[model samples]
Target: MNQSAGAAQHTHRYSVEEKIIGLFLRTITQVCSAFIRTAAAAALWSSRLQMLSEQSNFSDDENVPGSSWHTFSLQFGVWKDIGPVGPDRNWKGIGISLLVILVVLSFIGLSIVLLSKDTGSKTSGSPLTLDDLFQRSFQIHDPDAKWISAKEIIFQRWDGNVFKMDMNNNKTELLLKNTTFATFKASKFAISPDLNFVLLGYDVKQVHRHSFLASYLIYNLYTREVQELNPPEVSNSALQFASWGVQGQQLIYIFENNIYYKANVQSSSWRLTSSGQDGVVFNGITDWLYEMEVLHHQAAHWWSPDGSRLAYLTINDSLVPTMFLPRFTGSLYPRGTEYRYPKMGQNNPAVGLHVITLDGSSFTEEIKPPDGFHTRELYITMVKWVAQEKLSVRWVNRAQNMSVLSLCDTTAGSCITKHVMVSDKWLDGQNEKPVFSRDSTAFFTIMPLKHSSHGAFNHIAMISNHSSGKDVSLHHLTSGTWDVTHILSYDESTNSVFFLSTEEGPSQQHLYRVSVMDSSDKECLSCSLFRSNCTYYDAALSSDCQHVLLNCRGPGLPQTTLHKLSSMREFQTLDESAELRAALKNRRVPKTERRTVQINSFAFRLELILPMDLDETQKHPLLLVLYVFFFKFSATIPPS
Candidate 1:
């Protein structure tokens, strides 16, 4: 929907009665606040006057203490210090008394007004409508926090300014001002490894689910300068993809289907590949089939840890059938565009893994698949750099029934299978990247393990002797009925692997830290915090493993908080959704109930959201939507 349509749907006009009630409540609230402030001021003045009176107590014959004003001793000074003459004696005391009376009167008035409006305040507010839900009236505000380093975090404000916050001092400094590049709105940013330069992409035109064409620009944080990120051959043009390298200000981008590189923000661009076709062959980026079915990511490139080599996939879809989509705008007759989309029993795109050294000259070396696998029938599911010269890649067959994890030498472009997994049923499309040991001899990945009679649950297991090209032994690091959802981080300093799991329940996810040396030594980091409303959670750890950003995606309102790892204490609250909570306080929202239903040997969770005034005794229409595949896959993965 367009912006105007969205705004119109969220807008609501208040009824006459509602407007009147709202006006009355606002007026009463304002009056009560004013009265309270006035009463406080009056009480303060009365106390100060009493103190002055007590301090001004001086004997009339003592010529009054500090009596430099005795020169004006026309009886006025004596009268002023003492009291008024005649029936008006003790005038200062009387003034203090009047001030006290004023304070008491103000308090009494405020109390009466509050008491009078108590009944009105007790009335239930307006009923919640579909408009509220559509408008996301209760959605919490997130600060969009990202960790730039162990001791610092970068977050964007609502006004588009990015800020850097130091964890030690809790001080925030402006990193990027929105006004600096006000020419266009950037949809995303890629910060350099040094955190000195930011690559911004604007004028984004989405091509697929995760791919887009955007014009890129570079902003220097130190100099506060902005420059277009166009290659020398191309000026003011949109790029297919762009990102920073792992070291310094080195960067890479894809223009006209070809890969380009820059040593720094101010350096000239170099074309890395020349055999890129618009729809046939993709060099650094993925095509529709690879992006949607295999990798599930836009880019197929992986930079080495030292930024010395690049590993990317080349997908050729010339033999694949084309799918045409019609465009319905800018013409009387609709014009259509063609996309290479492979269907059942159709030719799949042939994929090849290639490695290129980035030391000035470039000659791409193709990394062949393992034995018994052909490049035409294989899919590269995951690519990760293990060391400066070693790369790990997972390849699955076209049927997705067999997967092979291999380690490749970047210098030779040769690979050897480290582990092989075969299943009678379809395997998980893309497995998570295995966290490798520092020495690259061992690694950790999630595999299904049988626990008692609960079938097989996904657990973390360490595989050793991977580098020896021998049969690796798997040792369980975590074993339970609950599934480990993700491997978040591995802290070498603490020898701890942090992960998220459904230990609390099927609907809940919590962060956990487990020792690699001792699997039995495990602790739940986020379980004790927010036990009331928060259930589902996700986390992002800093590189040094000193801090984490815990996201509470909840049964109640979601919140994001930064926490210190050592103490497990909250360091900062990125967002608590205070405004959203206030907006929902008086709303008559729907009631929800959760229940577990046991059918034969399987237990299924059921959640029902009912109307606020629902009548259980009466028959009501039911709208039931079932996600069979998702539920079954999550329940358990039966072993082959």
Candidate 2:
């Protein structure tokens, strides 16, 4: 009973015609979801990330050799602004000549000050590592929308030499005692759709690289006890996808292209839905090429919000052309890493999207298509069941010139479409997140208004699928130039969307709130949430929608702080470890002194840094000066 390969596909490859139709459906769905998701998960991570501080660095400048270029520039900018601009742009005029002469003298004085100043940007010593970096980069008092998420607060510290922090009585405590490393590591995590727990992780080297079972430890989080969610024996595969359900414990992850599910989080038993290892048929995981170039993930998959079925993009890369590049390690011969890659306007994976039931029984629906579509592998931005049987998936076209949002009717197994968005240039398709309202009648999407090259000025479009016997149209949200840094929060309970915008000035961010409404444009009823921004960072709202934990930077100190933002913006700084505090206190405190100098042909403003530890205030030896990048640096005191 071996059927022909062509005869076996209940869901065949999509023709260009089918892809067009799908594009239409997804666009409408995206607009509708954008309206809903705009409110649904807006507050998802913000409640957990809240940190802001008002502290001061010992000195804003340091005139020391090998100081960072940024620090020197900071000092230089301050010194130059000390004088006003010259005589209203008239240099040859009488009053202008005096202004010019005086300005020139001032410049010379500034250069002299720089030459004599002891300014240093960085000390590179072990104790003053990231803390110093944070303080400088983050300024919570006048922040550019900075945020820090103190992810895990554990009882017992995590081993493996990783930096750890713990929460103890309204303050964060450094728990990993007696360890040489004093800082935490960057987290690679995927939060579950259920929003109950976050799936923290490692790369392929830790998981499936050797054997799948051996690398299963990554699935479990917080045995050390900060926030624990119960889930059955679910092992995160190497180089794959995993997510939570809307209800918290339900989980889905890809294993060998096959999609698997565990209903209860605490159980170890699982059942397979697709026999994806057949190598030809892909289930939940994306093939290497699609995951790498287009999707930005090694896996091409997603979880439906309600968490009933898993919708995934499958790639049939068997026909794609492969190119080989030689790896020469200065040897006579070289080996190569062989794989499939799509060149500009070239062959790509035959893209297809499908929905599978959680029971491993059958496909809830398979999108049928024509042969003109490039169906080998498709770039699926996201998929969700907007309503009971209507699912939406955003699909990008092969040329990368346009993206098509498709809405599929699960029960009918067909899709009525709309061409939501079309771009003539490259764009960040992932930014096209589809948000749905609680009732699932309408949604919204924020997409590029012009071409991708000018995305900093993109427009937010609100599309509706309500039908209502009228023209379901698209509405624009932004009036002027603004780029979104983070959709900090969306509260359906309160009917508002909180997002960070750069409309104030380029490179600086501010928090803004917009009301969500119905067809009449009346305000929607939701939560009464507050907002706060001390410095520039991103944040995520917690599940309760009341808490926010973030990394905030002040004048000289950037630390993690937790805030109960929904009710009030109160500062709760994490406590520092005694050892770390002691180390910092004992380190050389560099004080910046302003000076001017004339070095070569350039008049410069300099920052002089003198060590504070010396008993004799003015007397010191070896005021060695070093010039780098044409900027002179010196220290009034030498290292002991």
Candidate 3:
């Protein structure tokens, strides 16, 4: 009876959003599959390491005194295949002793694995649920810009369709529709900093069996042309548009650990800055964790607004210990993938800052840290050149308690550590990157502010029986319950600061553009520039601040659309497909709506999206897990 109920529940869940659910289930399954593949790879590599060591032993050229440099070979005796004392069966004492020792060692190894760590700790595991992906404020900023473009994952669908919606003007154009191939779904994309070109990538099969593939396509807006940037013959995809070299003339992308560069508008040569191998100087780029987590960027290097010399990260990984993903095989040997990841309490990769001079042979300067904290405790995520000779660098300490923001003079090779930001929680989870003012005068940090007025439990002291104290500042930013959204860019021209905030309340993203009086006062002017009444809004600003793009989703909209912020007018409406839209138009159905929910003394925007088949009898399981570097809950029903 219980089995039947469970099956019914599972079936009901399928009705929710089969497309998204299938993707989730597939994503989850791939985790375990990848884990096994990694295990197998580690095993094979272990054998290769042993073989290489043995070959070195054989090839060793040992020089003996009073003798010419000649190859030396070691000759050792071993028990023969023939029997021992009498005729056939030989009782070798060493073989029995080896067996006993192996048994003892195997027992000890098993015990250590079982007792030292919990088996559940191996996998990162699926976060809370589908809805959670959108709830957290991971990539939020001050005074959210009007969005220029967007990429939204739809439910009940497999193929990733990318639509470029121009909010405020109301023109929804399809850039890349869904593909028939499931594995070739468009996963990531980037527009040239010049806004002239676009790059799209899809995850596919890798060159080796254990590797995964990433492919790219470059779209030119002026020429209305489309071309594949990567060579068709190679097995690689994980490609990205690192940064625009000035007029979008040069392109930078990463394939595995290697950084590739290509010039635009001609038959140009591809230059390799990184070669996947360690100990190489990386030009115009950052590493995986820094890109994936910290700076909220995929490109390691950044071209100045002028696109002159590039400011980027150069990782020195000669110290970090590599942890291999282990794969188990049912066959004679297991196949797998490999990478070097620094485990907790282990030596991490040494990070440094580098400035690449594009005028000639690139010159490099190492922004080495002063040896005070242990080397393993430092993590660098973002670095930007403040001027032709000045650089801004941020590093999170090992304890994650405080991150010291520093300015480096590339001219003198000097570093002046400035701001010290410590987490009020006292424990650092994944932290966000700092945003610099355009002039590079001051930096911004979006931290949590505890609310003492509500009398809620606050501090998570690193001790047993932690005190449930009220919200208060102890060398912190604020003393109330508020988490800072990301620190958006500063507009020096107007002395206006932009960022997203839950200062009103969480669950909704509101635009807050604060006008600063001076460095001392730091007071916000009452005359506001713009505000959004919705939960999810992404914005981009023009240099003059006259034009702003706001991508928003209000109540009842499954897909997000665009809007112009200043006028708060509809720019473009994003739809699923032409056919679907026509079919829906044929039916006289009620249009969806966005509600103004009161939150934090402010009316917050909340939009709703529902299934086409709105039968009350129909039930779909809702998954609400927040995504990394984001602050919204996205829901997707899994396939049964």
Residue-level lDDT of model 3, residues 349-464, one tens digit each, is 65655666555465656676644644456777556666666776777776667776667777567777655556644434334445555445455554443455653322211111
Candidate 1: give the clashing pairs: none
- For model 1, how does the per-residue alpha-carbon lDDT over 1-640 read when each residue is reduced to its tens digit? 1122322343333345556656665676576667666766766666445534544453243454444321112274442334321122345545655775676566556656654454343345677777776664565566788876788888876456788889889998887887755755776776787889998888989887789999988887888688998878759998999999878999999987788988888788888988799999999999987777677788999999889888888889989999887777889999988889887889889998899888887877888898888878888899999899999999898898899999888788888777788888787735588888878777888877887888788889888884667867878899988999899888888889999999888989999999998999999999878567787888999988888998888887877888898877655787777767888778766666665666689876767676656655444556555443112212332322
lDDT of 2 by residue, 1-640 (tens): 2223332443233335446555555554565545444433433223211100100131232344433312112363342122221122222343444554565556555544443332222232333345664652222221111122333332222232222332234443442332322221223344333323445443334322212211122233344223222223432335345555555577666655666576756655354554565434566665655444555454555555466666666677666677675667888889865556666666666767766666546555676442234564345565656775677666665555666666677656676453345566665645345666665555666665544444346545566665331357777554355565555555677766655555654434544556666423422111122222233433545543455555443223444555565433454544212233444553445544444455687545555454434333233465767653212568666434
Backbone clash total for model 3 is 75
TM-score of each: 0.73, 0.53, 0.52
Cα RMSD to native, each candidate? 13.9, 26.4, 34.1
629 in model 2: Cα distance from truth in Å? 32
Q: Which candidate has the highest TM-score of all?
A: 1
Model 3, C-alpha of 7: deviation from truth (Å): 24
For the record, the alpha-carbon RMSD of candidate 3 to the native fold, in angstroms, is 34.1
lDDT, residue 379, model 2: 59
TM-score for candidate 3, please give it: 0.52
Best by lDDT: 1
